[model samples]
Target: MIRIVITGITGRMGSTLLRLARDTADLRVVGATERPGSSAVGLDAGLAARLGALEVQVVDDLGRALDAAKADVVIDFTGAEVSVGHAKACAARGVAFVCGSTGFSPEGLAELAVCAKTVPIVAAPNMSVGVNLVIRVAAELARVLGPGFDVEVLEAHHRMKKDAPSGTALRLAEVLTASLGRTQEDLTFSRHGQIGARPAQEIGVQTLRGGDVVGEHTVYFFGEGERIELTHRATSRDQFGLGALRAARWVVGRPPGLYDMADVLGFQGNS
Candidate 1:
């Protein structure tokens, strides 16, 4: 069995992951954790009725939790700050890490890469398989459509989401830029004032926030004569939780490096 430790045991994704992990054939939940001072500390891994009963308890000391459990892989659905510590602990113990955390600082990502040198790490902003596939298709569209089409990405999330544009949006931009041979610094995030016509070399990003929208993303490729739009709407968080679990299973006993969902789904030409 693939022994796994889960961080953020009380959060939305954490609860969902716990429930999903129960159904996974070859994976077992060895441990679960919460940040220091969290109300969830000492709660059952199943989150007190949110999920059915699980034997594990949600603790604050990640190192102690992982060491005691001897987990082979650590799945982190925590925030960026907590995930850094989890990565460091997992790296020191040669434990593979699968992270669904987003909005990491540059220094945090640098630390994660360093950790990857010691144990495999799969980190992604969004863990939905369909979203990653959308990224792949968006890249192809960017390549074939060329500068003739104006590219715009629109994303919507729950009002509780902390990051604008979402991690999926940024990843989509990364793929599109690589396909078009441009850099993210060249893209446009907003247009309010008397901004002239849209630049052929720039991609536009827009965001919407409202009640209980799980997640939604749409990419528009527009030209003078035609326009094409591709979209992915997430109805539940279970999709992301399941995808993260799938990645955790795949990264077990693998070599050290950072990876993404594209790698999990075998998307061709991904770097």
Candidate 2:
């Protein structure tokens, strides 16, 4: 079994990852991390997940957890604030890293990237295989359909999701923008009172949050004759957990570099 180190062991995705690891035969939980002074720290990870005792302890220090657990790979679902540190620590220990965190600023992303030079890193805003496929197809549609088709991305998540438009939506916009040879400024978050007609060059991203929506993204390519809509909806968070587990399993023994779900799923999109 591959020894898995999980960060943010008490969070939603972290807990889901823990529970999923229980059923995965090739995987085993070795260590878990939480923030300093969090009440959940020091709890038995398996017991915390209601999986009885797997003999893994949840602690606050990521470095200590890795050393104590002798982790082979770390699956991080923590936020931007802590994930960079986790990546750095894992790389120092020669441990593979998989990050499913969101809301990372440019500097934060750069910090996480530095570790890829030493250890394999799989970083994706959304880890679900279906979402990655949707991005590939969206890029293909954008390339084949050309700029005549205006693109818009619509996303919805739970009310507690802090980031607007969602990271997955932004990723889709990036894929479409890159395929169409457009700039980041081409993304339009909202069209309000003063904004008149939709700019032909702009791609709109709209967001909706309510009623604990797991996650939903729809890409609309509006053309004169025919329009195409590509969509993916997550009925449960276990999909993300499962995808992360696969990434954790695949990243080990690979070259030191930054990768994504496309690399994990082996989907080749014409970039």
Candidate 3:
């Protein structure tokens, strides 16, 4: 069995992960954590997730969780800074790390890279397998469509989401830029009045908020009288939780390095 810890155990993704892990045969929830001073602390993790009690109490610190559980891996769905700290803790303990947190700054990603030198780390903005497949297809579309098509990405999420232009949208943008041999400098996040015709090489990304919507992303490649749109809509958060579990199972016993869902899904060469 793979012993795992869930960070941010009370959040949407964490709670979902806890319940799924409890139901999975080969996966075991060895520990769980929440932010300091969270009300969920001290409660049985399964109960906090409304899954009854699993005899594992949610703690305030990841270090304490790791110490108590002796986990082989940590599944995190917290914010960027918090996830980085969790990665460091897991690295120190020689544990593999899987995080689906977004909005990581350059320095934050650098820290994760450093941590990956000691322990395997799988970090992806969106952990849903369908979304990763969409990302891979977006790259292929960008390559096949060529510069003749004007590219634009539009994404929508729940208003409570803190990050604008959701990480998945940015990941799509990254792949498009890489596949097309264009730089991020070609990215255009906004368009205002007095803006002239769209630049030939520019890739536009737009954001939408204010909804109970889970998550949605669409990549548009517009050509003369024709457009191709690749879209993925997340109806529930369970796909992400399940994907994290899949990553947790795949990451254990792997070599130390930074990996993404593409790696876990075996899309490395094609993606």
Return the TM-score for each candidate structure. Answer: 0.96, 0.96, 0.98
lDDT of 2 by residue, 223-258 (tens): 998888899999999999999999999998999999
Per-residue lDDT tens digits of candidate 1, residues 101-153? 88898999999999999999999999988888888889998898888888888
Error (Å) of candidate 3 at residue 137 is 0.6
Worst 10 residues of 1 by lDDT: 44-53
| lDDT of prediction 1 | 0.87
Highest-scoring model, lDDT? 3
Residue 168 of model 2, lDDT score: 94
lDDT tens string, model 3, 16-77?
99989999999999999999899899999998888899999999999999988779999998
Model 2 lDDT at residue 194: 82
Q: Which stretches of candidate 2 lie over 4 Å from their true place?
A: none
| lDDT of candidate 3 at residue 254, scale 0 to 100 | 100
In candidate 3, which residue ranges exceed 4 Å CA deviation?
A: none
